[model samples]
Target: MNLIHRAGWRRGILALAVASLLTLAAIEVLSDEPEIALLIGEPYKAMRQRSTASIDPAIPGHSWFNAPKSDARLRFADPQFGFVTPLARFFTVGFSRDQRIDGVRMSPQIEPLLLDDTLKVVLDLQEQWRNAGWVPIRAEEFPSFADTPQWRDRLREVKNVEKAYWRAGDKYQLMLVVSRFRDNKRPTEERYLITLGIHRSRGVQ
Candidate 1:
């Protein structure tokens, strides 16, 4: 072959090699296991930073709801809170992907975590809030939530529900709800849903 033809052949080989490398990288990113996946990039950085973006409400004692250092991918602020509803902005974690949580929208892509791992998250949240002087309210205390079938079912699932509130003088009270559920489909493909929300206190106005 002439020099020009030889050069063209070399260029084609180089392009083909680059394409193969890119394809392999994409596969590694998509097929990463859960424990390693969450620790890979920005989400891991946020977790290490112990970001409280979603939990830090405008109310007092927000510092109490921070996620545990061992956990990652904990999101508190629902992306569509004030735009869609007047209710206080919500919080949730453990979903494989983020979802619009205006108290109505639910996430289908739940993350599968073991029961023990799920409880660790809930206890972490409850401990911090309790230390900050937030009082745990009984179900009967909030007739509206206690009476709702949806809330009742959610509470019954795994029986891991925590409801508490903290007051900021007389201005307003921040109500907190946290729950975790396992989506039992396949043993190897287990998933769990850890949800949390902050709303205006049930009765105090």
Candidate 2:
């Protein structure tokens, strides 16, 4: 084809792409929703804040009955069991990929982690366990993970490394990824709960 034709075609294609993006943006804006996903991970390693998410007027909630927004900004204490990062940003949106936060856009392409929620937390824990320098011990019952204690403690890096939650039918189950502590194994994944639903499930022991 001639240069003129090719240039025209390129311009048209670019225009179409821009138009598509604008349309998507318009749609997203029109929707009266949070329009984001949240990320959640295992118990954050160090920081601890006792919080209960309840219907807050500060956030956009119901007027008469006070309905809570379907979404909210997500944050996490560092996974008590050290994962590569501490927070999950699937249901929430944090800073970056390493720090346990992405964005929950409408697309499945997944530009980053979503708001801090259940899925994000679980994924972060799985990653931390994967790289804790243990020989893989395959198991069938757990179905999602296995435990193998075959790493050297020369550097003393792992401080009570523990497994994360894989969703069971009605409840959550925790595992032990690594448990070599500095002083004592004080971190029990049992202490963590869904960052979003902590108030609702006030029984996280």
Candidate 3:
């Protein structure tokens, strides 16, 4: 995906309002990819969340409500199997179509490693997600490693958003990361994305 960045200035408390408008304007004329929000009109239950009858060491194969986690913070059983601790947390809030929130509060108690030193702030207050401990890793560890099998089996698929755009203005930027995580497609997506964003992107720092 080709990311676009725009610069802006704020006026006052109404700065948010101004920036939001400018962001919309930038997006309107920025690129030529007809706006297509990821297909997330409906949510499917991950197989794992479907049956909690037993402490299924085998990570769920279904969706959440179907096999709910005792701790909402625990995004996956073997985080390596999916987005690690904090990353899992950040990606889970809107994972379900039902609990989608436009904004999320960053966890003051965030993992230092997960924090993108370059991008610095992973997801800003209005960025839609916050790292709650879930981290990202290669998908091979999970059974779905072969193909990222299903959304429930792939960590990347879980993090993908339906509609995301960044409005760069100040210390805190407004951005959205849309699209469902690749279901077990590329096992090394995190490594690839990290390499791309950090090594390829210039202003990340």
lDDT of 1 by residue, 1-205 (tens): 9999999999999999999999999868544322211111123234424443323222232212222223223333222211111111222322222311112122212354554554455556555544544555443564213335575465556666556444433322445454554555655533455444444344653
Between candidates 1 and 2, name the one with more favorable TM-score.
1
lDDT of 2 at 91: 33
TM-score of 2: 0.23
Would you list the C-alpha lDDT of every candidate in the order shown?
0.40, 0.32, 0.27
lDDT order of candidates, top first: 1, 2, 3
Point to the candidate with the largest TM-score.
Answer: 1
Q: What is the lDDT of residue 68 in candidate 2?
A: 20
State, as a TM-score between 0 and 1, how close model 1 is to the true structure: 0.32
Tell me the lDDT of candidate 2: 0.32
Score every model by TM-score: 0.32, 0.23, 0.18
In angstroms, give how far residue 29 of model 3 lies from its true place: 41
lDDT of 3: 0.27
Candidate 2: tens digits of C-alpha lDDT, residues 1-205 = 9999999999999999999999999867544333222223322111112222222222222112122234323322223322222322323222332332222111111122222332345445556545542222224322333222332231124333433223222222233232232222334322222222211111233
Q: Against the true structure, candidate 1 has what lDDT?
A: 0.40
